[model samples]
Every structure is written in C-alpha cells, then in structure tokens.
Target: MIREINFDGIVGPSHNYSGLSLGNLAATRNAGHVSRPRAAALQGIDKMRSNLALGLVQGLFVPQPRPAGEWLSDLGTTIEGADRHIAANAMSASSMWAANAATVSPSPDTADGKCHLTVANLKTMPHRSHEWPATLAQLRLAFAGDAFAVHGPVPPAFGDEGAANHMRLAPSHGEPGVEVFVFGVSGGPFPARQHVEASKAIARLHRLDPGRTIFAAQSEEAIAAGAFHNDVVAVANGPVLFAHEKAFADRDELVAQLSASLPHFELVEVPDAEVPLADAVKSYLFNAQLVTPPDGAMTLVAPTECRDTPSVASWIERHLASNGAIRQVNFVDVRQSMANGGGPACLRLRVQCDPADVDPRFLVDDAKLDRLAKVIGDRWPNEIASDEIQSQSLVGAVVQARAALLDALELSELG
Candidate 1:
C-alpha cells in the first residue's frame, strides 16, 4: 500500500535565537531572546507522537552539527576569533525546519519508476547553505534501497530552497501527480530566495514529465512581506491547493493551468477581503501542515499562533463551517521552533513510500519517540541566549549535547 511519511527534524541541542534568517518575522522579532533547546526538541518530538497517534507514519532526522565548523573554515576564521556574522551563521539551528530539506519526486511520477530526491543547495542564505552536505548524508542513509534515487544539490549558481518552494498535487499520495515549482525574481527589497532556473533544473533532473510540471513565479509583494518560501503562502495535499489570494504573481493563470493538467483540481483561496496577505504571513495561516489521513476527511495541523490571530481564527471558523475537506484542525504548540521562523509544517518533509522499504533505524515508533524525548529532556540545554552563542562554555555544551543525542538515538555513526 502507498503511504505518506513525515520525516521531522529534531531540534538541535544548540537551538538559539540569532535572527540569522532575513525574511522570517519570528526570527527578527525574537532575536536575542533566550531559547530552551531541551524544550524545543521535546516539543518537536511530541508533534511526531501526535501524528503517529493519528495512525500516520512518522520518521525522524537528527540535527546537523552546531557551530558548523565547515562554514568558519571556509572563511578562514577560527571559532574563538569569529566575527558576529560568522558566529550567527555557525550557530544557526534553522535546519530544524525540514520542509527545506529537499525536493522529492516519488516513484509514480518519475520515468524510471524510482523515487527521486534532490538536495536543496540553499545558496541564498549563508546559514542554510551549510545544510546540504549533512542533509545529503541522511537522505542517502534513510532512503538506501533499490526503490530510491537520491541526488546531491544542483550547482550553487541557481538558488534552490527544496520542498519549501515546490508542491505536489495528485489524486492519491501514490499516484503520478502535478508538481508546482514556485520561483521568485529579485525585484523585492527582501532578497528573493528561490530562483526560476533552479526549479527548472530540479524538474529536469528528476526526469519528471514536462507536461506534469508547472512553473509559477512568486509575487514580489509577498516576498517583501516575508514570504521567503512559497510554503508561507501556499500548501498542497493530494489534489487540493490551499493558498492566500496574493500567493502567486498570477493566481488565476496558475490555477487555470493546474486545472487543465490535473484530472480533478480543487483550489481553496483565502481572498484579500477576508484576510490580508500581511496577516497570513504574520500568523503563518498557510504554513499550517495539511494532511489527509485514512478513512476520514483531511485535517489541518496548525500552530497555536493561527488561533491567536483574530483574522486567521475567523477564517478557520469559516472553513470548518463549510464542512470542507479540512474538517478538523489540531493546534500544536511549537513556540520554540515558531520563534525561529518555522511552524508545524516547517518541521517535516513529506515522502511517499512503503514503511517496510525504509531503513528500520530511521523509522520511528511510539517507544522510540519516548526514548528520544527522555534523552532531550535529560541532556539538552535549558536556555541559550544570542549573546552567549560565542562563549566557550556554550560551544562545548553544544558539541557534547549533540554527541549525547546521537548516542541516545543509537546513531553514534552519525556523531
């Protein structure tokens, strides 16, 4: 049977607020505030448990090494004498948002009948660029079988943000689907992150049918308003597309193209009259994780922030009132991650494959999740403020904590 599995990134022990991300509001607003690393990991783990409870398949990805040595070495700087910019980028735990993990094209959509994955170079931001190598390692390990083909990131000239800039809409998780690749030009004040060329390169590399892929430009206004990644404005599950009115540069044209391509296309547009784009960005209304479970209607797994925003809350009430596909909503508290500019959807990467085909060590069960939580609670730091990021004590602590986590997860090889 076809299954949709969510592989969530475990918050690293070095979780801290340095505000390194440019277009994320939470990152800027919460900069320098003290962060609770232990709590952050537990919160993410709890989210995994929540999904598993709903009978969905869940997987886990351990955080990449903190105070990334590779970045410092590239700039010919030592950790002890690193400047503020270098230090901030080194300590970035942004990889916890696995939605940017990689762009995935499942078996049914590829010509060779093998699932394909291409790591995102993430060259737009210095902090995120360091993630590809480490992410590639994990992708190779978890998807090591005849059923998969995992490729490295494209050349750095074209900036790619992975699944964050791509969405797939199919009749079922296992069927051949239409892939939407969203790209942004650099007219906005905020640096446009995903490049159109990069999206085209990935689509070509995956050997996807040219007719099955659609290329659309992101709105420059949306980018300036902090919709750095397309996920901030739109999301897709099965054949349903939920987005804000200003999500794309030309929403009508894009929807028309999708309808023409797919057998049955469903679009749920939140108009500017009811909720403005600014409010959607602030509340992460579209960033909420939308999942279709077995034997029931689709459910929206949203962050608690959505409920707190007046306009967003009203939209949710109206959506439920219609008794549409999104019949239920589960609000989760991932404030620690949210403060770093990621919501529930940001923490996970969706892949369609059979559970039995995956590496046993990478797959998660309730017992394994509980053990992982205990490890984070017992070893991860209580707090890490921005000012203390470069301190020697915090450095040692970050290193030791990661080692402990690797050991606890029986992944010492990765450590």
Candidate 2:
C-alpha cells in the first residue's frame, strides 16, 4: 500500500503579487501585477486532477489564514495601519508553495520505520516566518496515525526551508533511500535561506543513518542567478537525479558521492550550453516534477513556460526523442503560480506512505475536486490588485472565502 502521495497546497484567496520573496526573480518582476485567486486555485485543482489521471496519488493542504492578524498584532499594528510592504506580508499566500511546508523522510529510510516530517521555520522572510505553527497544525492532523511522526520547526537560529531543499534517491518508495539536504552558505546577490547547520539538525531529528545522509551546499553562482532554493535547480525521484549543470557547489564530487552510495542511480544533467542558467531559471526547466507513475514510464510534469522557451523546448524534444530517463513530458498551466516564482514542483510536497494511514480528508478525488472548484468559483475573489490588499471589503471577502472552504472540507481548525 505504500505509495507517493503529492500534497499540493491550495491557493488562497489572498494570493497577490506584492513580491514578498526577496531572491525569487519572478515574484519581484511581477510585483505589482493583478492576481487571479479564483483562477489560480482552480488551476491548482486542475493540476492535481492531472496527476490523478496519470495514476499518481494526490492530497491537499488548505491555505493558511491571511491578514495574519495575530502576527501583525505582535508587530504593534493592525493590517490597515501597517505600511504597504508590511500589509502585503500580512496577507501573503506564499503557503501555496507546499514544497516549503516540511522535510519528509519516508518510513523506509528512518531508523524507527515510521515516516517523519519536520516543518520548516522559514525564518529568512518576514512574511514566511510565522508559517510553521499553522503548517504544523495541518501536518499533525493529516499524519496522526502511528505510522507517522510529525516534528515541530527546528530552532529559529538555524533556517530550514523544508522539502524544497531536500531530495531522496531510492530504488522504490518502500525501500531504504539516500537523503540529500541542500543548503546555501551565501546566496551572493540573494540571502541564503537554508543553513547547513539546520540541514544537519534535521538529519538527526529524522534519525537517518549518517552513512546514508548527505549535506550538499547549493551553488553561490546558481543562487546569484536566481536559483534561490535547491529545488529551483534540481529535483530527485526514484533513482534519478535531474539537475542543471551548475546546481551544486561541487557538482562532480556530489555526483561521485551519490553514484558510490546509491544503486541504480541515474543522472539527467542538462548542460548550461544546451540551456543557459539564466534561461533555465526563467523557464523553470529544472523545477519540473520528476515522477514515476504507477503504470507508465517515468514522467516529467513541467510548466507550459518550459514548452514555450526555445532553448528549453529544444532540449526537452531531444530528451524525449532519445528515450531519456524521463519518458513522458506533461505540461500544465500554473501561470498564476509561475508569475509568483512557483511552478508545478513548487506546488507539491511528496510523501511516500500508505494511503490508508493518511487522513482521508486531505486526499482528493475527481468528485471532491469538483466540489472544491465550486467553492473556489463561488467564494474566491476573481482578481486581487496590489492596491486593494488593505481594503476592509477585500479582507472580509478573503476571510469569508477561507471559512467557506474550511466548512466545505469539514476538518479545518480555522487557518
């Protein structure tokens, strides 16, 4: 029964383009543009449906409450009184990127034979720092069974950005795996969000074997080129590691180490000559979801932008034509998320576990997606302009919309 269930974060009604993420070029570039929350959420639901059609298990996380009223109160101000930057932080919906939710170690790789999840502190960004508590609440509920163990955020002194910076290479979902934790020492032009110390601490917390665990430094050049998190430049699934040429600080050494440590390991590296680093980051070619479907060849779930970018498109065609490790390429539209520096890979947190052990409410089906879409269409705002973030009317609408989703889901403790 053990399988990989991708838990995608539901796009919130407060989703906007305030450019809260510092190193993410897409978010910064589209800072003032209008956002379509309804469209965004629907798009996410459709993405989940697409995965389900591919015979992949799919789960969901409700959006964290916005206007983060309590967080704002601690800063000695309310949403209306806060400055534009602060106000935007208060209403940020960055939680939609579930990849940042937690670092998951499947039961097969853990010492106790139970899956472990450590919520990310996300201390680098003011808007994201307060997310752990809400994220922890959801994880606790979804994985309450004995087959799972959910840990709180690591100490704030060490920054941890979760699964977005972590990857596992294994023979299968139910087998012991080699886990890699990628951290940034210095982001160069951008701030290094994941600390090496934090990554090591998580390894201990999960009780992973020292021999099987790895701590890799993210490349400064890559981060400087807008590859903020390791996920932006690489992704791992099954025994394959798909990455850009400059993803790691020490690419050859890391590959040598991985090849020596893991069996049946395959590397699908895209040389910068084929697709330059700038274009790779812009098109999110490496951020694509690398998955092994239940009944099909290994697949790459990438964004439409990758298909549109000339260099990236050419590379993908060649990859497909060669019968590469990624046998199928499926393109999905998440422009709403893409504009904010998140792509298909960013939208999900992969958990390898038995479906029966997980809370059924978090799992979704086509019928359930239909219901969720109806709620989104009826309640989610059609558009969110930058200037309207502070309007009491919009705040009320956003708050009400979340409540409606919670009521419909029937398990929310009120995010």
Candidate 3:
C-alpha cells in the first residue's frame, strides 16, 4: 500500500551559525551565535520519535560530507586557505533542511505509475549549489528499485529549490492529486530562489497531467518579509492547504482553481488581522507539518516559536477551539534549526511510497533511533563557535562523527 513517509535529514556535526543563507531572516539575525550541534541532532531524532508516536512512518538521510574540502579545492583553494566566507559555505550543515533536497511526485499523480524524485539544483546560493550531487546519490541509494525513478536536477541556469516550493493535495495518499508549484520572481532585498521555468521543467519531467497541475506565483510582499520559500508561508497535506493570508500573489484565483479541481479541498487560510505577515514569518507559523495520523483528524507539527509568539499562539488557539482543518497542534523544540532559519516542516521531505520499497537502512524504527542517538551523543560536537570552525580538531571530530553514524547504521559506503 502507498503511504506518506517523512524523510528528515539528521543534523550534521558541522551544524553551525555562519549565516550562509541571505534571504532567511532568522539565519542572518543569528549569524555569530554559538551553535549546539549535539543538541541540534538530538532534537531532530526526538522529532522523528514523536511523529512515530503519532502513528506516522519515518525515514532519515545522513548528513552529507562536510567541511567539503573537495568542493573548496574545486573552487581553486583549500579549506584552511580559502576566504572565510567561502570556507564557511563549504562547511555549511544546511543539508539538514531536506525539504529542498527534492520535489517528489507520487505514483498516483504520475502517468508512469512510479514515484519520481527530482533533486533540486539550488543554483541561487553558493552554499546550497554543491548539495544536489550528494542529495542525488542518497536518493538513488534509497529508491533504487523499479518502483521509483530518481532524476538528477533541472539545468543550473534555472534555479529549483525543491519540495519547499511544491505541494500535493490528494483525497488520500493512494489516490490521484493536484500538484501546486509556487514560484517567485522578486524577493526585494533577497533573490527569489525558485524560478517558474524550473517548476515547468519538473512538471514535464515528472510526467504530471497539465490539467491537474497549477503554477502559482508567490507574493513579493511575503518573500520580502523573509518567507524565502513557498513552504515558509504555505503547506499542504491530504485534503487541506494551510497558508497565511499573504502567501500568494493571486490568492483568489488559486483558491478558485483548487476548489474547481478538488472536491474536498479545505482552505485554512490564516488571516492577516489575526497574525500579520511579519509575525507569521517570525514565528514560522505556517511552516508546520500538516499531517493526517492513522485515524485522527489532521494535526500540525509546529515549532515552539509558534507558541512563544503571542499572535501565532492566539491564532492557533482560536483554530483549535472550533472544528478546523487542522484539529491538534504539536509544538516541538527544534530551536537549533529554527534559529538558523528552518522549523519542523523545513527539516523533512515528504515522499509517497510503500515503506517496503525503500532501502530498509534509511527507514528508522525505535531501535534505530536509539542506536543513532548513541552515536550522536558520543561523537557529535557539543558546541560550535563561529571562530572555532577553522580548528583542525573540530574539523576532525565533525568528519569522524558522520563516519561513526554511517558505521553504526552499516551504511559505510556513504562515508
């Protein structure tokens, strides 16, 4: 049977605060703060466990090679001798945000009746541009069978930010769905990362029905306010699409098109009056994982920041008081990721496929989580101060930590 499995990236030992992302407000604001890599990874593991308790299946991707010495060398310098900014970008643990890893099309939505995954080129940011090759290798390893097709990436000329800008709305996981591709043209101070041409290329490559697919424009206003990716301001699961009021350039037209296509589409749009755009982006209010557990009503897995922010918290309370599209709210502590400009939703890539078809090693059970935690607690660095990123000892530990994880999981080929 087809099921929705959320594959979350394990936070890397190199996870730090270099603020490599320009459009992400949270990252820029917290650029030089000391980071806790150990805590950050443990937090991610805990998130997967919590979701498991909610009766959701979970999968994981190991952090890619970091202190990317090879990438720096390709750029005509060594890690220790390169410009600090360039070196920092090479050491980035931003790979933890797996939502940008790929845009997945489930078999039900594809003409070939096979799940398809297209890894994002991510050409807009230098730190992220080198990620696709690693991400592609992982995807191929996990979904190597005929049940799935893993494509490399769109041309580098057209920037593709992956699943963060894509949403699928289906009546059920096994049924056909309408895919929405949200692209941005202007981000004011920041460059809009996902291009329309990239989205169209993915649609054609995925073999999706043109009539069922919708290409919507992301609002410039929201992007300028720091909602860099579409998922930052909107997300969809099953029959529901939860978004902030200022999410789209043409909200009315998008809603009409969706309603006309989907018989049970639920539009749970949070109004600007209740929670303004600034608060929405600040608290990552709309970046929640809207999931339908085994049998219960859909629930939202949000970051703790949502509860801390008064307006977002109040709006959530109001939504829960009545029977809304999302009935329960689960506030998880992923502050490490949040402070670096991501939240619960940002940490995962949703793939619709049978759990049996995926590489068993990537699928996590309680025992796997326990084993993973042991490796992390033992080898992951305790803290990563910006000034200390260049330390040889720190670099050695970061590399060793990743290798240790691969060894524990018996997937040493990745190392």
List pairs with backbone clashes in candidate 1. Answer: none
Which scores better on TM-score, 1 or 3? 3
* TM-score of each model, paired residue for residue: 0.98, 0.99, 0.99
TM-score of 3: 0.99
Candidate 3, residue 394: Cα displacement in angstroms equals: 0.8
User: How much is 152 displaced in model 3, in angstroms?
Assistant: 0.7
* Candidate 1, lDDT over the whole model: 0.89
Model 2 residue pairs with clashes: none
What is each predicted model's overall lDDT from 0 to 1? 0.89, 0.94, 0.94
In angstroms, how far off is 220's CA in candidate 2?
Answer: 0.6
lDDT for 303 in candidate 3 is 95
lDDT string, candidate 2, 1-415, tens digits: 7999999999999999999999999999999999999999999999999999999999999999988988999999998999988999999999999999999999999999999999999999999998888999999999999999899988999999999999999999989999999999776669999999999999999999999998899999999999999999999999899999999999988898899999989999999999999999999988888889987599999999999999999999999999989898999999999999999999999999999999999999999999999999999999999999999999999999999999888875755
